[model samples]
Target: MALISDNDPIYELLDKWHEDDEYEKILEKVDEIPMEERSNKLWFRKISALNNLKRYDEAREEIAKLSPRCTETADIGRLFYMMGYIYDQKNCEFKAIECYRRRAEIDPSWDECDEWVNDSLGYAKKDMDRAYNAFSRFFPDYAEKNQNAAEKKTVEEPDILPYISAMGSSFMSSNLGVKLPLDQPFFKCSEEDKPKVVSFLTDRMHITDLKSLQQDFGRNRLAPLTSNILHIIETGEEPPLDKLNAQQLTHYEASKLLLGKMKEFIPEGGLAAWDYSDMLAIARFMYSVDMLTNTEIMQTYLFANDECKRLFKSWEEFTHSLTIGAFYNAFTRDTSYNINQSAKFAINVGLFCMQTYPGIEWLGEIKE
Candidate 1:
């Protein structure tokens, strides 16, 4: 057999982790490898993962590090686009506009920037209206005096999604055998209310059972390392084993043992099996019950790459118009048992599903 390129496994695992939404793992795994083995593509992916995980502070610092090292126009375009996205999420209106404008200069056909531009403008209008309403209530002449001024002034909207999105820590806790309350609207609740809400849910959710579950879960202390081996199996790639430890070697051996079984679930068409509701249900159930191991989850991701893109071409398209079955499949695939995130993801997916399949309810327990 021909010799395997050292970079092959790096790209393969990177793609696998990206596909599975395991962002932090990408950085950790990359860091474990020698510095000389790193590349611009790896750095770009690290930045992308950080953004997706909502680590904006680290992502911005990384962007600074990558800016000088980058050479390709395509990489630069993606960098600017991601920077614009981070700015938008940070509620930096003008800065976001500037980044998006810069991105447009490079890739004019990028329509998401235009949509975000409009979103920023709409948010500005709402902020002005809200502020005026509050101030005018206290000062009657305030509205008349500042109506023109308000139109001229910039408006800033708080980053609602950051507060609302299911945080990674929540997932980690769930993975550690802390049974989360699926019915709780923790993510949707205001930041000030999350602590009290969580306290309330703790007793009500019966998380005391964690004492027993903890015995089997073992705190997942080795989870970080074990997870990497799982990714290797899922992506069907073999990294340099000489660099790994005894524990990781054991995990790798276990993953290989399960690889064949994992492939059985990944259908040829992957996400295109929209009509295959049975398969979707099977996948969801397997994930929920922990039957689909980490490697198996990767197998599905590997299988879905081309098909998912075809089904939901853009981030906007997927966010506003994903199918119910598809949403469940993605949500349960690798949540670390964080049902709140699963529920929140389902709600977002349902927004678009309702537009297409009016009043449709794919999940019996979870409603849009």
Candidate 2:
């Protein structure tokens, strides 16, 4: 009552508020408080509260008043942080981003704050809700960097002949019009196992020729499975499907990819494709396709260290062995890739080839 003094100069400012709307009165009382005092934090907090209360105009006015003082003080820095939080708390994500940016400009070390702000913007972009899930990989810079590494590595990989010399083909078809990729490794392995396969791919296989293979044979389909299933299979006598949380999803994805790749070679009604209902059939188709196109590869081939090349070469012969191998697994007994995961992997490679290379003849090959 004393602060709302009967003779204070700002007293009328409060009286005028008695007849104004209740929220407006509260906001006015908030205005009468001194900007510089022990209560500076309190003042800014009220301003943030006002902004959340939908008094954005009032909030801007308060910000304008503080911007000069807010030039570099830790107090001002904290106020901006609250301002950003207010925006985010209100679900005004862009406004939140703007606040975070403002804070970052005030202090670049505010990058920690920037991470979340950009993340919010990524989610709040709200343009493609159905594709919003894919936006989870919002680390766009990371993807670009990885892809650039892949391109450079593709170019540096060694020649194709030495590696192919190691690959087993029954009889030579000279002028082999077949197209095999020079860069993409053909062994059937999951991406988790890719690091282990990298030695083989770089030393003996090629990634650059991926584009060429798709040109000759067809394109690869991308059925991206989320979990890593390769480790379990290599260590266990039987393929371990149940150990993974996403085993079922990975299984289905492998099936989809295998089937999708086969569709490229056989099209919709092709007799050869129809013959392969089980994963083994699909796997064989992939191997046959690789054999047919082995000579046409265009990318640089890597000479695997003798041991690694030998392993990959032996892989080609026994690659067919894993079909009955995976089929015996409890999860794959009825599943498609059970017959031969390697063959299925080959088909996936074909799909990857197609997607990466873009087949000119593969137009309209995907089934409706």
Candidate 3:
């Protein structure tokens, strides 16, 4: 299907309609396009509008009509997902499970399908054993692949554990009179002790209230600066300095300076590794405060580990990236501060983590 570019006026209008909760307008606009001329994107938007408006019967009808026309796996998977969503909303657990499972079968990489299937099974009070047996029988290769991946992860857990300590140690060691037990692994703290550790770090970080912290962390304030720097790096074309005000120009210059230093140590991944590390730290903190679950924390850790290992060859490179990232973030917030002092402090934190932690070798391999 020849999809409409997002910049197309009609597409933007449709997006505006979606954002404004004008579902009826979306249906009307979609219908204005000849049925044969409509793209899969338009059809998906129409179906989404119907689903959002709680017109489940109409949504299912649209799905049924669209199903046979879907030649691409992505479109077919989406159709099944929409159908599953409609069934779930109507409390038809069995139908929802069937749709979700079909979606998963067609696109094994669609993790949400598996999540919906599990949710539907729970709602139906179906035995997980039976579900697993059925799944294994149909997708033996996929099942075995996942099993092998899980085994590989289990084997690598210990190697990754030390990195977690290194990641969190800068925050832990900053607090005076707060120390982790010397003999015990940092992550092996008792449930009762976990809150204490979190509390100490939160206090040190001056996070007195959850509401404020959540508001601050909800969006990356550095995104604009980061984007500008990345654009300059990729294209070798500078943005119009005259267009930026004094404050923005200052920030742009700082971003370039920090990015230059970052390139010295980080061979790849650039700001992405820093973003993942930030997420990892926040996820751990959130888990401690009951804002996130242990499962979510582990998922965040695994994802961060994968990306960081792919980007960096050794712990020193990762540390340098983190240090520059920290300095960039802080300097952007308060450019009045001495830049050299701030950079030194951030670098010292990374150095402290490497030196103070027992198993954190500076040149340790970031295992693949």
Q: Output the number of the lDDT-best candidate.
A: 3
Q: lDDT, candidate 2, residue 60? A: 62
**Candidate 2 residue 98 C-alpha distance from true site, Å:** 4.4
Question: Would you estimate the TM-scores of all the predictions?
Answer: 0.35, 0.25, 0.43
Q: lDDT of candidate 2? A: 0.36
Write candidate 1's Cα lDDT for 1-368 as tens digits: 33235467677878888899888899898677665656767777778888889999899999898788667777787788788778667654434555666676677677787787677545534433443333224222322333433233221112111111112223334433342232331223344544544443344432222242233223322223334544666686887877754334433443333223222322322223322222222222233344455555334433333333444433222222223223333322433212234334534443423232232112111112
Question: Model 1 segments beyond 4 Å from truth?
Answer: 1-7, 109-111, 141-368
TM-score for model 1? 0.35
lDDT of 3 by residue, 46-101 (tens): 99999999998898888888878899998988887887788677655545666666
- Could you tell me how far off, in angstroms, the CA of residue 198 lies in candidate 2 after the best superposition? 66
C-alpha RMSD for every candidate = 25.6, 20.6, 23.7
Tell me the whole-model lDDT of each prediction, alpha carbons only. Answer: 0.45, 0.36, 0.58
Compute the lDDT for candidate 3. Answer: 0.58
- Return the candidate ranking by TM-score, descending: 3, 1, 2
Q: Which has the higher lDDT value, candidate number 1 or candidate number 2?
A: 1
Model 3 poorest 10 in a row by lDDT: 127-136
